[model samples]
Target: MMMRSKKIKLLSLAILSIGLSQNALAEDHWKLFLKNAYIDRDFDNDAVKDTGSWSQAISLFYDSKFQDTPIDQLQIGLDANVQYAVRLSNDKHAADSVLPFDAQSQKQASDYAKFGGAVKLKYKENVLKVGEIWSDSPVANIDASRQLVGTYLGGTLSSTVNDHLSLELGVLSKYSARNDDQFRKLSYTQNGNKIQSDGMSYIDLKYRVNDQLKAAYSFAHLENIFNKHYVGLEHNYALNADTQLNSKVRYFNVQDTGSIAAIDSQNIGVIETVKYKNHTVAAGVQKIVGDAFPALDGYIPELYFVNWNVTGFFKKNEQTYHFIYGYNFKDYVPGLNALVKYSYGEKIKLADGIENNESELNLIGAYNFQHDYLKGMGLQYLFAKYDTKYGNDFDENRFFVTYTKKF
Candidate 1:
C-alpha cells in the first residue's frame, strides 16, 4: 500500500512538473470541443425490463500543445475529457447505475463523468506518448459507437516512414471499461475465471502501395495469456463518375501461450460493396474455424467487421452471411440517410450435434441539420431484432439526438 501511494504521488508530481515547466516556454496551442447527447433505449422480452428512463449526457474534450525552441520537432501537450450523464427524470429506473459512452442502458453500466487526462510528447514524425486516450484500433480500442467510450492507459511510439509505411509500438497496462468507472488490468477471461494479465504490448504495421490499395498487419500479446495477429487488405475501384466498388479481406489468428492456454483459432472474412449514385449495397461472408472467438474481457462489438447488432456470431465453427443496403438523401433532403442490414449465421455445431443458429436485422435512420445555427445538430434512430436457436431472442430500440461544437 505504501508503494502504491508513493507511485501515485510520483505520477502526480510528474504531471504537474511537466505541465508547469512547459507553460513558460510553450507557445500558443489549445483546443476545445463540446458534444451533447440524449439517448433512450428500450428492450423487449428480455430478462431485464425496459429501463425506466432515458439518458442525457454532455462531454468535453480539451487539448493543448507547447512547443520548445519555436520549432515543431519537440513538443508537449496535455489532454483531458469530461463526461456527465444522468438518467431521464421520468425513467422509473432513473436511479439505476450508469455505464460509459457504450451500449445497453438497461444493462450494467458505470459513471464516466469523472475527469482524466494524459500527457503527450512529440518529436518529428515519431511520437512518444503516455496517457489515457480513446482507441479505435482493432485491439484494445474504445467502441464509441455508443454514447460513452472507454479509454486506455499506456505509452506508445508511432512513426510514419517514407510516407507509405506506418509503424507503432506500445505497451498498455490498464483500460477503463465502458460499463465501469474503475480502470482495470488488461486481462482475458476463460471458463468463468478472470486471468489477470501482467502486461500487454503490440506491434502494428501498415503500408500503402497506392491510392486504391493498402495492406496492414498487427500483433498484440499479453504475457502468459494469448496473442492475436491480424492481416488485412483493402481496395477501392471506381467504376465511373457515379459508380464504384470497395472490397476488403481480413484474417485473424489467435493462439495460446504460457500456462493457462485456452483455445487456438482462425477466422477469415471477405466483403464487397458497390456504390451508385446515392445508394450502396454490400455483401459479406465470414467463417470461424478451430475454436470459439477468443474474446478478451471488456472487449465488446467484435473487433472484426463481422460484428452485428447483437453479437458477431463468432462461435466455434460458426459461419455467417451479411447483406446491407444504405441510401444518402442529401440531394433529396440535405443531410438525411438510412440503412438496413441483415446477418444470418449457421453451422455452429456443438459436440452433441446441436447447431446453434442466429440471425439479426437492423434498421437505422438519421438526419443532420446543415443550416447555420443548427449545423452540428442531428437526430438518429436505430432498431434491431435478434432471432436465434441459441436462445436469448429480443428486440431493441434506441433514439438519440446530438449536437457538437468545436472551438
Candidate 2:
C-alpha cells in the first residue's frame, strides 16, 4: 500500500509541474486568516458529563494565474495553503464518558497541530489537479471547522466535453482527521491489529438541459473495500423577479466490494449476516421577499428515508429525516445571516426488539464587518440540541470570532 501511494503522489506531481510550466505566468495573490472558537456541551443523562473546549487556527494561502505564455489556448494556475491549530481548554473526563474508545483518544483530545498543501494545473477547458484537496459528495463531505482548513491527498481530472456536458475522475487516499504532511495511509486498529482500505477511485458526469434543469451521476469504488453510486436531479424556475423555485432530488446506494465480505463471523456473530440499504429525498423553496430583503437562503422541506449498511456505520439499518432554513440580510443588515435546521434518525430493528432513535436541532447567526481597516471580520454563534430515545439527550453551544485579509 505504501509503495502504491508513493507512486500515485509522484505521478500526480509530475503531471501538475509539466502542465503549469507550459502556461503563461501571471501575478501572485496571497491571503491570511485567523479564527477562534469555543464549545460547551451538556448532556441530560448524568452518565455523560458536560464538557468545554476551545480551538484556534491560522491559515495562509497563495494563488497565481498565468496570462502570457507560449500556449495560446491554455490557462494555468497554482494554489498553496497551510493551516495550524491548538486546543486552549480541556475536558478530558467529560469526553471519555460518551465518545467511542478510538475517537476519544484522537478527535476529542485537547490539543493537536496539522498542516498540508496542494498544487494544480489547468489548460483551457481541461484541468489536472494534485495535492491535498477538499472533496464532497452526497454520501460524504470533508468538513472543516468553520475556523480551520480541511484537505485530502489525491489527483483529479475535470473537463467539459461541450456546452452541455462535463466529466470528472479521480483517485484518492483515505481521509485524514487533520491535513498532515504524512503521505502514508493510516490504519484502524482492532484488537492490536491494523486495518486499511486498498484505495478509492471515482467518476462523475453532469448534463444540462436548456436553462432550467440539470442532472448528475457518480460512481465510486473503494478498491476491494466498497462501492457507492449516486444519481441526482435539479430544477429551477423563475417566479417573476422577486420569487423563484428550486428543487433537488438525490439517491445513493452502497455495497461491499467482491474482495470484502458483507459478514465477518470472526468479528461479530449473527449481526454480520445483515446487509444495509438506504434512500434519501429533499426539496426546498425560496422567496425574494422584495428588494428590501434581496436574498433568501431558502428552506429544506420535511422528508425521510431508510438506510441499510452493507459497508459502513455500526448499525445494519436506519431511518432519517432532515429540515432546514436559512436567510441572508443583504440590504437590511448588509452582512448578517440566520439559519435553523433539524435532523432525526434511528436504528431499525428486525425480529429483535432494539430501539435507538436520535434527533437534533441547530440554530446559527452570523455577522461580518465590512470596514477597510478590519475587513473580513466575522462573529458567529451556534446552538444545538440532541435527543436519543434509548440513549442520551445533549445540548451544545459554540461561539466564533474570525479575521481574514488577502493581498
User: Who wins the TM-score comparison?
Assistant: 1
TM-score of each: 0.85, 0.72
| Pairs of residues clashing in candidate 2 | 276-308, 276-309, 277-308, 278-307
lDDT tens readout by residue for model 2, 1-407: 46435544554564455346434433477667788977777879887767656777666665666444577776666666655555566645444212111344444533333345556666778877777666664333453543354345787888999999998887777555432323445233333344455556788888997788998888877665456676777777765655556666655555555542342211010100111111112322211111111000111010111211111112334445555566777667878888676665555343357756666677889999876777789999989887766666778888999888876
Among these predicted structures, which one has the highest lDDT?
Answer: 1
Q: Rate the local accuracy (lDDT) of all candidates.
A: 0.71, 0.55
Error of 2 at 392 (Å): 1.9
Model 1 alpha-carbon miss at residue 341, Å? 0.7
Expressed as tens digits, the lDDT of each residue in 1-407 for candidate 1 is 46435544554564455446446635534332333434444444556555423566666555665455466578777776655554444534332223433335533332235356777778878877788856555655665655556677888888888779998888888877655556788777777778888777998889998999999998988787888898889999998999999999988888888647587888899999999999999999998988887776765456655444545678889999999999999888999999999999999977677988989898999999989988778888878887887566766666778887754
Relative to the true structure, candidate 1 reaches a TM of 0.85
- The RMSD of every model to the true structure, in order and in angstroms, is 5.8, 12.0
The local distance difference test score of model 1 is 0.71
